[model samples]
Target: MTAHQNGTIATEVSHFLLNCFVRSPSWQLWLSLPLSLLFLLAMGANATLLVTIWLEASLHQPMYYLLSLLSLLDMVLCLTVIPKVLAIFWFDLRAISFSACFLQMFIMNCFFAMESCTFMVMAYDRYVAICHPLRYPSIITDQFVTKAAIFILARNVLFTLPIPILSSRLHYCGRNVIENCICANMSVSRLSYDDITINRLYQFALSWTLLGSDLILIFASYTLILRAMLRLKAEGAVAKALSTCGSHFILILFFSTVLLVFIFTLLVKKKVSPDVPVLLNVLHHVIPAALNPIVYGVRTQEIKQGIQRWLKKGW
Candidate 1:
């Protein structure tokens, strides 16, 4: 091809090659099996939890509704990223179209923020249930859940829509290789020939502002819940409170820890292996998803009994 044609193709790059762990072809075979299993586990677990919640009329409450929302978000996240990753690993099909890549980027960015917002709302639900029992019925009604769902969608969509828009506007000249499993905002933006200062700054500011605020609110809600729990005078009240909040706390801890680790790895990308952040990013999507429903099913007695009933009915 002539230099002119090369430049033209680069400028009008229609697709990108995802170099997902391409440095270790042998590892792809090993990674493919486990990733596939995790994907299946996440789908099945979340599906079961959703079905259990739907069928069990007794479980029709704000908390379970929020849990269903979380499951839905997890399933969307997994579906958005995992199938393409598995395809890349198993069949060596690394090419993703330009539009598809940006669409994936949008879903990843938007859904993650939506999940964080959902967690924050769930914390509020728990707060009302544990701290203000009398008002819990009034405050966390089906109407309230519906409003929260709307807020989650609106807030995340309004803020996150621009990430892909900003990223997609940048010009790509000859370099079309993305060095990660998914079209992470930065991973895609960095491949562009255009200056991405605005893109980076917007993403950084938005991420910290959106997710950071959610974390702060969640922490505050739990703090109040803990204070309320400590003031309990009834026998086994504290134990019961702990049991109630334990599952949520565990999921929040894991979610925050993994996200913080991924951010840290990105900050020190120059010092660490390039694949470290990539691996963390990939696991962050699947591990928590697979764990969320399992943790809830095991820790919450209502959910467990509901699952048993669901299974019995299935049989």
Candidate 2:
């Protein structure tokens, strides 16, 4: 418990989602209560979103179908890591084995990749529906959506699985403890005594390619939608069009800020205090999970009515 061959860095990391300083006050501090609430809020909102779509036949259209898929992705994304995250915050700081950590990272990256791909598909779906409403059904069939989803899954798996391969090859001379909350790639890579040049290069390239492409496609679709809305020549059409896009735009902005903040924090020129970076990381994880569902629910009337109906039936 006292010495290490690597260096004199007095680091004792628990193998858990939340790498709280155990020597300090217990992890069940006041802040944790609100985080727990935020986690529950995310789960409930996503569950309500899925239930609303399924219960309403009027919402059985292709647009709602894609929304439900997005909700499902969000649900799975939260479920995969949030349980472990909460466990660390509430219970003991559970240690993540090397394999378990790799698996969690892989799955997290897969869902993130899948979510990005789904947005591109959704952008195209919106484009077809708005730009060519008459041919919406012909252009976006149930069979087509199924095939598209499959392709998205295949592409994400093919590209992202290599991350673990690269990760596994690296050896951890000391305990496999990650700083900050999650087993983030950056955090893990910092510990490696081996070369990480190629891994870092690939990560940079992939982030630029995937997230950049999604943002480009999303903007392109909105441009086309705006053109169509203008051509409609109806006064209310502009308002309605903005309403339709508001939720998706919010998601894009939220994610982009998280990415930028996390990346920029890493690039800070000054002496970036440790706690600041960790809090930024927490935002990247928590804010989206907490705010997204509220954004979607407040913006969509159909979801509100469905929730009301479900509540009435329950009572």
Candidate 3:
């Protein structure tokens, strides 16, 4: 029998069931293999990137510092969502405690926003490096990175803290099934019988405002960068500029594209299989985590050289 509550507040409900593709039990068994592999790859790649940046003196630049921070965020974000998901797939451990669910939701919201902010800052870093080469050192100092770090953390935390807190206060009223692998804001908020329009509207407004602003700024930075490149007569200058910015651009492109796809899937949820959104949601967390390091390792000369040196030393 399912749990029931008489009052408006559903405080009696201790946990919520994460209905991660319950209709297709057998398919989960097969899906678990790839998910597990992806998780491992995401972990290994991001860890390698972090350690490489830390150990290599040559990579001690503002650009690499931001990349290292990106790797850290990617790793934490992947860890936050994927382990519980894999547990659900492998062990049928679908019940998440109320507090744990809220925590997961908080981390996902904050870190994802932080990642977007980091990308915008990184775009600025590239812009300064390419467009104003002589002023790069003075412009992107260690103090600037510290300020940017504070901004990313403070902006995201302050904006997103309300989401989980608001969800926690609502009356669940005994409907505890979240039909997704991860604890999302709407997933939790929708369970409330009370008015959730405020929560939903705030979430929508905050998400677009933060991400949209970052996207606009990043696009403008890159545009100016391209314009600066165009003014240069030497082909070598253009190639050098592209080489430096290419990895960051590619990763941001993938990240933004997948997120857009996820949003589109949400808009057209009725037309597609329910599994599609779930799968996309899960992939959005892991795919970018796995790709960021690999793109940097291959496309980034400094990181590639650092990896080779680290391999030689066998650490």
For model 1, what is the alpha-carbon lDDT of residue 79? 95
lDDT per residue for candidate 1 within 42-146, as digits (tens), equals 999999999999999999998999999999999999999999989998788999998899999999999999999999999998898899889989889999999
How should the candidates be ordered by lDDT, best one leading? 1, 3, 2
Stronger candidate by TM-score (1 vs 2): 1
Write model 2 residue lDDT over 231-298, tens digit each, in one string. Answer: 88777877877787777778767767887887787789267756556656554555676677678778
Each candidate structure's TM-score, on Cα atoms with residue i matched to residue i, is: 0.96, 0.86, 0.95
Local distance difference test, per candidate? 0.91, 0.73, 0.91
> How many residue pairs clash per model?
0, 2, 0
lDDT-better candidate, 2 vs 3? 3
* 1-315: candidate 3 lDDT, tens digit per residue: 233445433444668999998987876888899888999999999999999999999998888889988989999999999999989988899999999999999999999999999999999999999999999999999889989999999999999999999889887767889988899989888887778998899899999999999999999999999999999898599999998899889999989999999999989999998888888989989999999999999998889999999999996
Name the regions of candidate 1 deviating beyond 4 angstroms. 1-10
